[model samples]
Target: MSNKIKLTVLGLLITLNSLKAQQTSNKSYDVCIYGATSAGVVAAYTAAKYGKSVLLIEPGKHVGGMSSGGLGLTDIGNKYAISGIALDFYRRVGQHYGQFEQWIFEPHVAEDIFHTYLEKAKVPVLYQHRITAVKKQGNVITEILLESTGPRSVGRVKAKMFIDCSYEGDVMARAGVSYVVGREANTAYGETFNGVQLTNGHQLPDGIDPYKVKGDAKSGLLWGITKGQLAEKGSGDNKVQAYNFRICLSNDPKNRIPITKPAHYQPERYELLIRQMEKRTWKSLQDVFIWSRMPNQKTDINNRNGFSTDMIGMNWDYPDADYRKRQEIWSAHTDYTKGLLYFVGHDPRIPEHIRAEMNEWGYPKDEYMDNENWTHQLYVREARRMKGALVMTQHHCEGREMVQDGIGMAAYTMDSHNCERLVVNGMVKNEGNVEEGGFGPYPIAYRAITPKETEAANLLVPVCLSATHIAYGSIRMEPVFMVLGQSAALAAVKAIDGKSAVQEVDVAALQRQLKENPLADGSAPDVLIDNSDSFRVKVSGKWSVQKRGGYGPDYFLSDGHTDSSSFIRYYPDPNIKGRYEIYTYYAKLPERKAVTAVKVFDGKRLQEVVIKDEEVKVVGQTSGEWVKLGDYIFSGNGKPYVEITGNGEKVAADAVLLVAASK
Candidate 1:
């Protein structure tokens, strides 16, 4: 079906299924956070850390939005930009595995880590409670109506400060925040990467033309291509980023569950893919996801190769969708992706090699058991960007203009999913997943998290901030979300302290607090050292060490379907078991010259471990070092340690570089 028709049907279903319930509570609190995403969790925790009463309202059963959901692969651009609570989250993750962290890992590990944060903060999480009504008076929000799924489920509460951390900006929308959805024309932001373009830079299989009939205009458009009104390139439209479920796959014979045909699975749905394969234009497996953990016994399969299950150009209307309509959209995407998997695994039309490769992977029985082996969360990339006091545009990201009120920094290039589907010269083509190069990390403005001037006075939005389509793509990462979440909470507390709206919070003071708490950048007076690698760890004035390497193909695919260049490892050494000590402490630094030598000290003398460097290349992407450290060599009291005494005044001692592999 065409996108327009799918949107119309989904929109109508939303209208029909929508129901408004009555308000029942009148009590108020100090702070309120809407949408129980990772950002929401951070915001609430920050507010509570400041000794304020916080009420967290979630629209679903789960609290961690994309973080705990299927998106186990966290897209944290610049880790250094993430500080405060956000840094804490990854630190906790690293702690869980007793090793350096990566972007993509197991989903359950993410869930356990997030819940650990919530429990530590002692925040009240009201699940299965959707906000029914939001009332505002002048610059202040009076109260919000929340309806629960259980008996006596209706209640209302007022809050001095509110935050919208939802991916869709639902709370901000209900509170009357002005926002824009979909991509903006190039002229709108003077951004070269904003609008639709088929540069073939990130295209699916070459020669797999979009049009059905090759080089014949008379042949007409093919199936799934929307027939009505085509918006001009770079022009504004209701279109948004694509959404997909992160499939958790495994090759463990004991735990792997083969892809079973869904009850509604239809072979016809996959005919399009088969046609492409028949023409010898089948998609390659370069970017297929295979997440490796530290105790390397598990695997998390992700989109590694092109044409993987990212239902691109299909989720334009989801950000503002009502509950029921959202459900329908979710169902459609699930069916589409499931069918894709089934087609790849079972369809006889597929290449024997491709089918054999796919058959080797299946859902891990140990993960997401509650959802019948399906990921519980549908990865929502770009949603409603709540237009706030300051709109973070492409200019801010390109470093042409620095946000004075920097809460955090984003180092990733502006990355957007394939946003358009077109047939060029009778070949099927897709566009919009643009990737820019050479652009380092840029600071995120505090205003991006605040409510619109006309919206609620105290609410803060961290997850869905005020950014243009391309800009949001870069900022909408997990670590950045956590940083913004903490910043939002800090601002809320400051507002409550000063009796002012979030819009009116002092920028200078906010900056000071942010620096102290240091969510945006790790640059802080108290921090001893700060260094962060793109898509990895970030610390505050603290020195950290990472031993980076990729797992084997059974552990981490060098080439898959989702992203060929993505550094993913699915296996780690299991037989070599040993406990490594991790220490976090404040210390004074001694100035020195460049490094003379590197040594690992285990209390008395130097320690050693076997380091294996493997040259495994993932097609169409960068190669990674597959390093292995002997577990027996790095154990005991203060074991597997690195002693680096270089030049510096102070450095926050975060983690010891237990392992390091030169690529």
Candidate 2:
């Protein structure tokens, strides 16, 4: 059947389901998780595992959000910081592939893992149940009404607690939660990278024109080009970050389905891309096409460089738009992306080599079988972020501020995708792509997910929790979402047990529980060092102590300008003796020095060894973990020590671990 006809039939089935569900009475549960995303599924599994009745409500036919969608190439920064249910999910994915754990896999494989987790937890999922209305009584949510789109009709779910795990924060917004869309000013939260960043990074090729007619001011701006005076940097605005589909493409003939022009292909929409190609402004198509390898030779394709997969400036209305409007936006994105693919593969204007390369890849026929080989979920990178009891800001991610009641940790860079395509100095430039990093793993406060007491007391927002734009960029990773989902579930359970508001849950108790509960395999590390232990420091310039969660609460950072004369040294116990491998843990950030020199003093010799600190590379997948420096022999009576000297870049000096290597 044609795509339109299939959608019509699906709509009719949903109407019939809604009508059927309206005839039944309201069902009660201990927890109602709206939007069966990866976060929602994990929340349901967690609540159900704790013996609470969970209703997993999904607005669409499928679940598992982006993970089950085409975003199979995980964007994990510090994999070691990921534990509990988040780690379990990856381990399950690994199990399916006959490995200990698989970080990259097929979309269907991820969906299978979600299904297994939910099924094992015995949680029932209600598909096509979009939350229509949320009933609130004073401070608590009384119930939620869902309109069915398939076989069930209108259904009411009464739960003591509700978790908004949707990417859009639909349920939370309906429940009168305060949320802010788009970018906030840096001054609003003392953040340097928050708002209106036109010149920040991710600029298009230097000479691309903004007008449809080159050099003609009267000519209207090209499609997708915003014509306006660029906003001052660090100022707040309503423009949201870009969104796209994490497309799954394949080169294997057995699975590849060649990109075809959409039914409503609009060549004019791609005028800018064609212009760039014709002008020979870009080096290669690969500059825009970032295809990361997934399992089975498939690829999780993403937008990169200038004018890529991200439909810039088209998703501002998505967070608040009604269901029908969202469908329209989704269709527009699909057409734009598919058209780009088709143009790259067929347009003669594209270089022949690039065209040939594009033609080799297409949608994987075996994936997204139910959705015409397209991913069901859109990459809603940023949307309506809730302004909860505690708003997480760049300060938190940078370790300038720390949350004592941290439920989990996020260790990724404070990254933001391009937010606007603007006319700058008579040329087209993409704005708001700030990729700042330096701070290590930071804690996610429980209060950040909890709504204010005056708002709904029972609601917890995990995916769309309280955070600034730059901070959200780091927190929006799938693994971090899963971690927050599990933490939200535990907090809900605690609130229910204590008969207290979600905002009033005892934080100390929550922290204690979280720390005490190790992984199911009992592999969590024990706290061995006290915070009071101080390393002797001699600084020629300046240094400061910064505390974050995954970095064992305290670490030292050099000033942005590093000098060779500045260094920090630490002396080990005088009695230590044996061949030991030295490992240094620092926040892996893009802005870190490519190499940091560590002066090691072994009993036999003193030598300087260079350590590569770039965290972006997948070297042993040890971004946040202990990175080995070198093995050295220490005498039992000598004062063995190590010194870190600056190399003119940002340097993080967290605690070092000395493991005994086999002699």
Candidate 3:
């Protein structure tokens, strides 16, 4: 009886006892959160902390969705923008590491933190309960029916507020809320990056054949290759972005479990990858496998390059698939990933050096012990996004528009993994990988997370909120999900207290509670200047506003071109003059220049500070949060201006903030 197994059994026992008790009582809770994801956990905790009785239901045996499943290396765009319960989770994670806060951590550590949150908040969580049906009266949900495997076979939870925090938006869809699956045409939302991106994206190596027989059109296409005429760029389609498992691996022999071929493994499935390897000379395993280090010796392994981990074009049926069908898809992805590991380590065609290096790394024995040393959750990148009153489009991400009723911020790039694999002009290519960044942080509108009042007034959706496929790409990060989850719970609590619909809650009141700050004069801090603000653009190239998920919106993107010089200048108010801390918000992209030159004219001298692209610490109070450049004295005269010039590298002049150091 290992301690891990004992603890898991005890937790299950507690959950069963709680479920049995609840079923008998038939007590209606103030809030009911489904999914048990990082968002769900935080939402449950937030609701409980605010004096609302919360019921956290999870379909799986484990919690924390991807964060604790195997994604140990957190994908936080700008750590500063994360606040409230989400930030508290990270701070607690840091405490476990004996530091103030830490982003990258071990999977078990994250799970422990989630458990601690549940215990401290006294939130009762029922595990392995799938939502069978939702009972509703008009637009308000009355109760949710739950089905379980063991002792407690069936249960129902009545709650005033229901939050669909599942990654798949299962409850949202089952409840008859209007939602969408697959990509939308670029024209649908006046977006440039939405829809069927067949060209100018993540493509396979040149000269690869898509047919089983070379130069023969009659010969059927190879396995995993879709057969069809490529759709026009930006055209709408039913295709979805790829999904993969964030497998946790380890090189330490003490904890390593060798990768084995899956039971349903078919060598022909990965024929494209073998062909790719044949054409290119291998450098190292790192060229194909992306291994990011966790706190322990374990690694968060992910797909890299064109032919990597993402199972492209295989998840198109996942969004609308039933539970049984979804399980099949999950199994397929697991087999593909496990088989890839085994093939890379043992295949004869692979280079000796690459094979040897891959063979050294294997699954961690201590992690995900019950799931055969593999993550139980599949990384469902994009699924059923709700079509609510407000839709977060690329325009919102590009800073062309801003949501006034903001619940949280998202700063990650508008990233979408490959969606389809096809043959283009005699070459096999992977399509739909949009990695556009340069926009700063942008606010996720409260309306986006809420369903239309006519659809469902009592239900709040955080994980599968309203957004286009491209915008959802940026909003899909785990941290941002947690942030939105907290906000959604807050909104649910407010609605329950006010006896109002989720959409009818005062936006300003919610913002005040979220900000959690008040001045001596009983006024909230003037958080000024988001990406939606108008700015003066000057240069040969055009400056566009872009939105980073988790962070607010940013302005001034050069579109990855260095030859075209551009400058974005901002003038502060004439009456506001003092020693102020200047912060520049931009995407922390890998291709960003090491040093970006910015000139500040303080009505006396024009000073230049070389700002580092990697500095993402929140310095002072402002709406747009990012790295601080430095503090400088600004004359009361309206002439004080700051200018950002694009000189090589991908320049992102998103937003600038000047906070008065002294009033």
lDDT of every predicted structure (CA atoms): 0.61, 0.78, 0.78
- lDDT per residue as tens, model 2, 1-663: 554565565455434433433433366778988888888988888888778878777888776899899888787766655767887788678668775456788987887688777767877777777888989899899998878776555468898999999999998899998999989888898888889776535567677888888888799899998766788888888888899998888889877888888789888887878766655455655677777778787888888876788999998899999999999999999999999899888887777888898888888877776688899999999889999889999989988899998988888888888888978888888988888876667899988998888998899999999998889998899888988888888889888988989988888887776566533222332222222256443445567776543345466677867678777776677677777777666554545677777887764578887877554233223344455567777778666677787666677766666655541
Question: Mind sharing the TM-score for model 2?
Answer: 0.79
Error of 3 at 349 (Å): 0.6
Query: Considering TM-score, where higher is better, how would the candidates rank from best to worst?
Result: 3, 2, 1
After superposition, which runs of candidate 2 have C-alpha atoms over 4 Å from their true positions?
1-25, 278-284, 518-663
- TM-score of candidate 3 versus the correct structure, residues matched by position: 0.80
Candidate 1: list runs displaced more than 4 Å: 1-26, 100-103, 149-152, 205-222, 228-232, 279-306, 517-526, 530-596, 599-663
Backbone clashes in model 2, listed as residue pairs = 14-149, 14-150, 17-150, 17-151, 17-152, 17-153, 18-152, 18-153, 19-153, 21-153
Off by over 4 Å in 3: 1-25, 199-201, 517-663
Task: Give the local distance difference test score of model 2.
Answer: 0.78
lDDT of 1 by residue, 1-663 (tens): 543564455344222222211221335678888887888888887788778887777666565777777666555543445567676576566557653334555666777676666666666666557887788898678788877763335477688888888777877888887888888888886887787755554455666644456556566665555544445666666676667776667777877788888767877655446554555454443333333331234443454333556666677778878777888899988988787787877888777787787787777776665467677778888888877778888888777888788877776668887766665544566666677744556788888887766666777888778888888877888778877888788888888899887877887887777666553323322222222322222222233332121111011111112221222111112222243322221111222122212234444456443221122111111112112222223233442333322223221222222221110
Q: What RMSD, rounded to one decimal, does every model reach?
A: 11.6, 7.8, 7.3
